[model samples]
Target: MEKILTGTVVLDLTRFFSGPQATLFLAGLGAEVIKIDDPATGDPTTFSPPFAGPEGVSFHRKTQADMGIAYLKRARGKKSVGLNLKAPEGRAAFMKLVRSADVVIDNFSAGVADRLGIGYETLREANPGIVHCSLTGYGSTGPERNLKAYDLMVQAAVGMMSVTGQPDAPPAKAGSPLSDAIAGTFAATGILAALLHRNRTGEGQSVDVSMADCLFALMFDEPFDCYRSLGLPLRQGNRIMRFSPFNAYRTRDGWVVAGAATQDDWNALLRAMGREDLAENPQINSLSWRLANNATVDSLMSSWTEPLESAEVLRRLNEVKVPCSPVREIGEVMEWAQLKDRDMMMPLWNPLAQATVEAKGPGFPIKFSASKAAYDTPAPLPGQHSREVLMNLGGFSAHDVDAMARRGIISAP
Candidate 1:
């Protein structure tokens, strides 16, 4: 299938999660993403934990020769080019590459890009059609723009932690780094939108993504509505006040979550639980009545589910077409047959290991009949394509490349 972004070129200057994740999405859609890293220390995460090497090897515990799992998961389908962006020669070479690229992404602090002289204004001057995206902790033009924000901090600042976990327990962060993931996803969306706009008008623009802002946007709407209506947004763990029996319940073997939003759905769930008496009971028959007596509703569902195995409970719920499923572990999700059939799990050859490794890709979530996303390239080694990119894309000669490498302007593989 033809890839959606077949001809696009991207210059990736992002480290860590957000920016790299965004470019991974672009790469999956067939954009050629060239990751520019510092020669001294190529992507800090490359040295971090959860490594994948030749089958049974653990890279982090053994050696730093292999890339980390975090980098491998997000750096697929990219070429690595190491250049000292702080150097004048490197800056000139980067400007030359900018002229030939469609997008440039960074996730530095607010003013760092501008200080490094690779800000949107400067890049746009070199290529007016360039879509430059800045992913930061906070937005560029705000009081908190200069503040440092990691995933947990953003979650806490944006009230995501407050509404998570049981009310009895202290506020807890989500298991995943939702803030960075969400911001990166938004960065990809914003870049795509800018690309579309550029296609029409032959003009490119800056896309500023704030992690805190993204988290705020996600947690704001409902809270803002509640605050306006009732002075505060009450935090209800697992289930919202608007619904009953809409939470995870313990089963004999594991846990399952089930919900019945409508009267019909509730009746179906009751029938599935073999509780026709409850189905016909007037006090809890309708959704509103059940919500008013939510404690009783939840207790009844718990009693029905507590004794059954998770799989059996899921089977019973599915029999009545009630929306329910077992709360799967990460391992179970990784091996899910349905997801595998849809190509969500993609394998790439780890160059260091000389072995194939599996990682999840975006799965071309929005499928097209004649077009799809691709994940053919594994993440590159540091400076893996530095010479090739300089010679081919930057139009530098062999002698010039050698001279630049010798001068600490660029790194060679």
Candidate 2:
């Protein structure tokens, strides 16, 4: 079947992580996503890199620039249009693109789109049913709305760092830019919902997503007040909330994480560890007692696991249906059999690298029984599709695109 969003058009004005990541999901679903970059500088990410190799990640250029690894990952399956929105002619061209677009997405500072004259209201004037989504660091109306933000900054602001890492250690950000990723997913969800609404009512609305807000929402998934009431420290590293025996354990070879999600699994895990006698102990079986005495549970689990090889520990747990697995390193995960079997390993060609590297991105995690997802195209050069998109979708003539290129309003190569 054709891709679900095959007929959709998106004018993408996002940069860096959060905004681009949201549009990436749309592109995978087969939207004709046109990424608008500044004709001269292009998206800032293009210049920011470790390239697929010291073509070290200003990371954008083909002859003089090495495309940043970030751009290589996030910009796949999308078109690029290098059109300046600062000039009058450029704004006119943008309006023309808007007329043909079903969605407009930007991840700029609160007033940036307004300063560029392509804010939601302006775009709505051009196309009444256009779904405009603005993804920002602190959202549009807060006191911190105009504050400069990055993924790390948002992580700190949202109090995520407070609960991350060991209580005694300096708070650490997750290995991934989680705030950016989560916000992107939320933004995409809002856009999809708005599109559904538009399909029925023929009226468009705006989606406002804040990086800090999204992360904050996730942090509250557990009851902080309740944990505090139980005299539990908010940050216990891997010691999860209200859950005992749900942490990483040291093994002879490496670390293994085993967790019991229910009483049946808890009993199974006890039997697997040759400690079935503890199952009859009332305090050990009480959920509150276990949570309060998590240290005792960990000490017990570790006593068994530490002397065993990680594989043996995992095998014993698996035999009894007690969920467990060895901790995998980054390289191990990259070569993991399961992910590869699901077609998550992808080959990305970097022209500047002059080589095809089997990079691990451009893979979507979702499966559709009917429709499809796609991730085959590489990121475009600055304005690579300027002439094509403007002429074909924006209804501009080749001569008009050429004139705009000459006037420094757009790039047409």
Candidate 3:
């Protein structure tokens, strides 16, 4: 079967986690994504590292190796081009790419793209069928548009921080960059929607996505209910407000997570623990009563679990059809068979380090019957394809590319 986006060309001007991740999703669906990066520094992520290179150095062999891991995962089936947008020649070259592209994505500060003359209006004027996507901190027009943001900032702004961690403790940021990931997913959805719309109308549209907006939107059901009916939802650690005996419990070896939201699940959990007396108790029969007496129920459950090993407890819980899992750390999860079987983790050879490294793979949610979304290429070395992409795709001659390179309009490292 034909690939979903086999003939689509995407001019990706996005950088960092949010924008790159969004375009990566599109690329996985078979779009020809040409990622444009600064000829000088490239993406800021290239500089931030706990890499295998020399200490206190930038772009060391180790840093490049780690960056390659991310690039390998995110830029599979995509091309990388280096250009200086601040320069006129680079801008002209970008316009050339835009004219032939189906989509253009950017994750710059609110008006940065417009200043560079690559905004949706400018690009659409050049190619009316171009699907332009802008991922920003707060969106293009808003009181907070100019405000800078990052994953942590969005987490704090969107009340995720407030709702995380223990109730009596200081609010803690999430372990992962949830805001950026969520924004990227939202941007991908928006771009896909725009692509569908363009197929019908033959007119491209601009999709404006804000990390803050996405985060707030994700909190809808609970936060809205809290604001409209109850007061702000109190921070409840681990346990769900409506469910009892549905939290992490300490086991002999480590922690295990188990939840029984429904009556049947509760019964199964009680049966798993061989506590038929408690299972038959009317006081703990209904969800409302169980929730009301959660402290007692939790105490009883903990009494049984505290003596068992985490693995044994999880085995017993699973055998009886209770929703339960062991608390797995990152290292343990990296070796998990389920994640590996699902292709959520992949290993790629890094030329910089001359070694193989593991990285998170593309998360394309939909499964196609014929054309599979698979990783095909590693991330480009800085400016690795600058000359090739400009000369081949942008229709520039060798002399023209050489002159531009000499003028610092493009760089190939």
Candidate 4:
């Protein structure tokens, strides 16, 4: 079957995590995602890595020949085409490529694209129906647009750290770089929606994605609203502001998590603990009463679970129809048959290592009944497809490519 984005061409001018992540999805969906790197430096991440070495770290300083582990993870199924967009000739070459492309995406800081002379207006002039998307630290129009955007900074700016971790402990970002990843997903979604609109109207539009905005959109949706309305500390650990007995409990081996958002669930949880008789104890039965006595409920639940193994606690909770799970180690979860069956951990070919390795990377989170997504390819070496892309899609001749290469505007490699 034809994939969702088969035959589409995307000029990807994104670097680092956020932009590459967005292109990664488009590439997986079978789009011809051409990653435009600088002929001089390539993608910065290409050399900024431990290169998948011992202990997942390398003591040796990375040389220009090395590819970053991060680059390999996110650049799957994309072609690397290098061009010196800083040069006037390079800008012209990019415009030629853009004229044949359906979409153009960049993660340049605010004003960078304009200064490079390839902003939305320039792209639109070259291809009127082009879908131009920009993923920045903040939106282009915002006051903070020019602020240097790091994952840690974005997390702090969006108040993600404010509500995370233990209440008394220091603020923390999620283990993963969430804002960039989320903004990528959002950018892909917006591109798909915009494509639908263009199909009907024969007009393309610009997609402006702000990392802070994207995280805020997601984080503020329910948690922030709930915290404000309930007047609860944002950083309280594990438990929800309104719910009682909705937290992780210690078990003999590790931990187990169980939650009750409804009366039936609450009753079933009590049954899980073999305390069905207490379900109707008015002093502790109803949610309102339990909310006021969270410590008591937690203490009682802990007493029940502390004696059991995580497996046993899970078994009892499952048997009673309560929503519960063991606090699984990520490595252990990676080996599960369920994840293996679903292909959540992908076999990615690492260029730097020249081997196929497995990591717990996302593998097409969405499933389609008729459509399919393929993710067998690895990321490219810097400008690896420079000759092919320019010669074919950009309508350049061998002489033209050689001249550009001689001028140091495009990578000959």
**Residue 210 displacement in candidate 2 (angstroms):** 0.8
- C-alpha local distance difference test of each model: 0.84, 0.86, 0.79, 0.85
lDDT of 1 by residue, 72-127 (tens): 77878889999999998999999999999999999999999999999999998999
Off by over 4 Å in 4: 53-66, 223-229, 358-360
- Which rank order by lDDT, best down to worst? 2, 4, 1, 3
Best by lDDT: 2
lDDT: the better of candidates 1 and 2: 2
In terms of lDDT, the poorest run of 10 residues in model 1 is 56-65
Kindly state the number of residue pairs that clash in model 3.
2
Return the top candidate by TM-score.
Answer: 2
The residue-level lDDT of candidate 4 at 266 comes to: 88
Q: Per TM-score, what order, best first?
A: 2, 4, 1, 3
Error of 4 at 201 (Å): 0.4
lDDT of 2 at 70: 81
Estimate the overall C-alpha local distance difference test score of candidate 2.
0.86
Evaluation by lDDT, superior candidate among 1 and 4: 4
TM-score of 1: 0.94
Q: Give the local distance difference test score of model 3.
A: 0.79
Answer with 2 or 3, whichever has the higher TM-score.
2
Per-residue lDDT value at 263 in model 3: 83
